[model samples]
Target: MPDLSSFPRHSWLRALRQGLSSIESQSLGYTSPKGLPDARTAVSDYLRRTRGVLADPQRVVLCSGATQAIALLAHVLRNRSVAMEDPGFWLHRMVFRHHGIEPLPIPVDDDGLDVTALANTTASTVLTTPAHQSPTGIVLSPARRTALLEWARAGNLVIEDDYDAEYRYDRAPVGALHALAPDRVIYLGSVSKTLAPGLRLGWMVLPPDLVRPVVSAKSLADTGSSVMDQLAFAALLRSGDYDRHLRLMRRRYLARRNYLLHALREYLPDATVLGAAAGVHLTVRLPDDCDIEDIVRRAASRRVRIDPLSWCYTEPDCAPPGLILGYANLTESQIDTGVRAIAAAVGHSSQVVPDINGKVAPDSGP
Candidate 1:
């Protein structure tokens, strides 16, 4: 067998290393079910300055991770119906199901979720990733944002999954929809995409009505995340180290993104790269003739893993023949090698690579 150890590790390890070196101590005790008070306070300030959302520290509930936050929120809203993006984060839907609330489908275009389609869906809660819609890599349109806020005026709740929210590189950054309407939106963010998913650390800005129940739910779920990790994160945020580390990661991931774009052009023809700005991964859609599953199997055979976009959808029809390549983990050279392997295995080109480099906004192509 060939040596398969040459592959690069995912971004999680790198984040863990950063977290360890920056804040290396383990307090190892159980934290508050409502999360670290100081951490919540700091998060409130951070959101105010970063995303323009004015949040109450007391209203913030910290938990194990974003997924846990979602689960807890679903539990709290069990009586209410749920609405989610059609090609939304599948795991989010799974959590809703586990809690006995099935999210209604909301299809999306390049401009993010279809707010118009949401008219008839009866729900007091709607989950969405607005900063950068997953899979499609599109920002939510301003009109849709307005409409969503309008929907919220009717007492609808928006679970804002700000996953990969800080990684923007292309157009001007999109302000948090939560900021536009805090009471109507429940904001969820974590170190999963930013620092490390393993930390199992995340926070949620709950609606006033749901705060107590959600906190109780969290307490019942796991009591809380690690005290030391939460404290360390608080210290890191206070010390500005988290921002510094994010700056470093931005520079690093941007370079990797460029390399991937180049690979698309050189190694594959009739291919388009999308979702480059502000996230760890980008999706590349191949032409119709390409066998996506075959390409995936081929790439895996070469000892590299690439996620197919179709896996994210709940609907029967897949969007396109594509793969979601997580560039944040791989170095530039590894990206070149991996893309080359994928291209060669998929009957594309081994010799050519894209001289073009960039993140495609919504409407360009999937």
Candidate 2:
């Protein structure tokens, strides 16, 4: 989730007003499940410019959100199980299961999903977050990226969930994986991270072959996404308001992330922070013996909420103890208070090691 309080309400309202004033009455009747033409074109232009996605408006299908896009794909790719990252987004697993498509869990290391493990699976389709792995925040390495695409070229399909790739703080965001193999990769993205989840706006840049079937599934699911909303978004994109809003949010989120990093350094010096270069959240690896459930309870008692990393794993008990903390929605003061509370909860459970300077050392990962 992004900082919902900072949603571009004024810009969106202006777009909506402009869109409503000019929209044809026929457009209000019903729209193609592939989405309105203007909207698709706008999305295509934005993605190509920012993420290096090889998107053609003709191949772009708009849906309510990434959730619906997943559901539509599940429906289209019926009877085929899909490979997923072990510590990936749990909701995606649930959506796949709901459509009776079982998900095969592929292990994720520091370089993102293990493509070798994925290739070993019988599944022909795989869902991945290559730009920034969910929960873990590791980017797919170049070698793994090449391997994944090669696997795709071998009659397999890769679903690239390019979620939250727009918020990199330390450097420019990575290019979408779909850019390398447009025909083999299905790129998924949504406004859930940048603008607001409530907008329920998302897009799929599909392989030419999957477009019609997925669009048919989308039609059966909701006839089509809200046309007015689509037009409003198109207007927003055309007027450059969307890009402006993203620029503002990036600076805001970066400051929040820094504050959280500082808090962690001051309060939990023994913890190791991973994937802090981008995204709204970062992962903190706890000491081996720390009781993560107990930490959760302790933090909750102090009015601080944190997600246990185990919840993202296929087998929760087997996961290493850690916490996934989001600072995007918190103020600096709130972040400090929350970190202090978490530190107090951790107490003496964390085993601290001194560096050469004899000070407790803090560590970070790329």
Question: Which candidate tops TM-score?
Answer: 2
> Number of clashing residue pairs in every model?
12, 0
Predicted model with the maximum lDDT = 2
lDDT of 1 by residue, 1-366 (tens): 011222123333443354455542442455568876777888888888888777899989888888898888888888988899877777887888888987888888877888878867776678899988877688898889999899988878888998688888876778998887888899988877776666788889877888889988888887887766666677667667677777877777777788888877777656787788778888787877777777788788878888888777776365667788887777777788788778765663222323223222233221
Off by over 4 Å in 2: 348-366
Model 1 residue 97 lDDT? 87
Error of 2 at 72 (Å): 1.2
Error of 2 at 255 (Å): 0.7
Worst 10 residues of 2 by lDDT: 357-366
**What is the lDDT of every predicted structure here?**
0.76, 0.88
